[model samples]
Target: MNGVLAKYSLNTVCNEAGCPNKGECFTRGTATFLIMGKNCTRNCRFCKVAKAAPEELNPEEPLNIARAVREMNLRHTVITSVTRDDLPDGGAGHFASTIFEIRHLCPDVTIEVLIPDFQGDYVALKAVVDANPDIINHNVETVPGLYNAVRPMAVFERSLELLARVKERNGNLFTKSGFMVGLGEKEEDVIALLTALRNVGCDIITIGQYLQPSREHYEVVEYIHPGQFKKYEEIAQTMGFQYIASGPLVRSSYYAEDGFNYLKRANATAGGDV
Candidate 1:
């Protein structure tokens, strides 16, 4: 898998974000592709992806990603990118191009894109929505109270609006969002965050523990127990989320196909095209 990624000059959030589940996921012949560039424009303190001047958008990226997906014979593929505030559309057009190329080359593969907020640009967000990816994910990353400290440039409400807009534009597209725990958040904050996500008609949710990337980044406030993660899963399920994943090692795209597949089966059973 690493050889395939390198051969295509591709990047994966598994490596960029120091995801602990990379080894297992790669060994299983799957990875979440990171596009646009490795350098993020935003200086989110909790992220491990490099914060520097955003790199130029590679024109060949969409086709290269399609070729790589074909080479890997992936049934489900997840694509994410560094926040590209430098771009006029926050790289939304690039995301749409990638989604189109993937569908053109590998029509059977399911696609899920973890996208930036697009700086609350509804037009930019609509571009990706119009492409009609199987799932659209924009993570809140943390509770609203910690947004200033953990995600300074991000607006919690904007992220919610992004997710909400996905459904408003295309109700068939599964909307997903995620947040990290152990960020000195109280139980009420977590519950409130979940409620907000559900209120926006988010179909899938992921909850994970925050691991500080380096000494300079945000510190881990608490190591949440597995039981607590289970509790979160239960709460989200009760809130009518179609799918929920909660655990210490869970990332936005970890076992992502499971959620997509669950919705697929449900929709088929209900005689609706998903």
Candidate 2:
């Protein structure tokens, strides 16, 4: 069913992170394929993706990803990847190419791209933004104070800039980002982070509880309750986000289809087509 994705010279965040929603997303005919090799060059605390030398980019990847997504019956698909800092363009070309191919394969499907920071490469970010996917998501995984501790190789401000630049480059493309709580970040810090993202004109926000994947990775500091998540949602909605997917289960793409539907409806209404 996912032959094209398997054959493509790519890997996905969904698989690397051990997401709980994978089975449901796959069964419901959706997947967030990772492109541009599985080896990430950066070393983030909470992530399990290998840190090593990445292989050469496969030119046929776009075609395979497109065909596989088509065969998978995806009405809404997400394409994300491990950070490939080894590449000159930070794998931005591959991300854009995959989006183009997926669009050609499933013209009716809404494609959301959970992209890398492109190493704060504005031109690289623009390249992907210029492709015009339905949504562009860059995750600022934690608060600033914890960013260096948790994501030493990743800059918190740079991630914010990526989201800001994407919106600047593609006003119509729904801009999204996420935060994983329970990594020792305080409630006030979380709110401030959310506020900063909103200030940058982010259209969508996902707030989820972080579950540490392995002993070698970051341990789960605290397990947040469902009620806390609801409160977060309320706060996020008030911050002017168009869509807020908040819950214990809400990873960036947990409710992949719902996000697409929300964006489509909002876009239609904005255009006075509703």
Assess candidate 1 and give its TM-score to the true structure.
Answer: 0.99
lDDT of 2 by residue, 104-134 (tens): 8789888888988988889898899889888
TM-score of each: 0.99, 0.94
| Best candidate (score: lDDT) | 1
lDDT of 2 at 122: 90
Write the residue-wise lDDT of candidate 1 on 156-177 in tens digits.
9899999888999999899999
Q: Pick out the ten consecutive residues of candidate 2 with the lowest summed lDDT.
A: 1-10
Each candidate structure's count of clashing pairs = 0, 2
lDDT of 1: 0.95
**Residue 69 lDDT in candidate 2:** 77
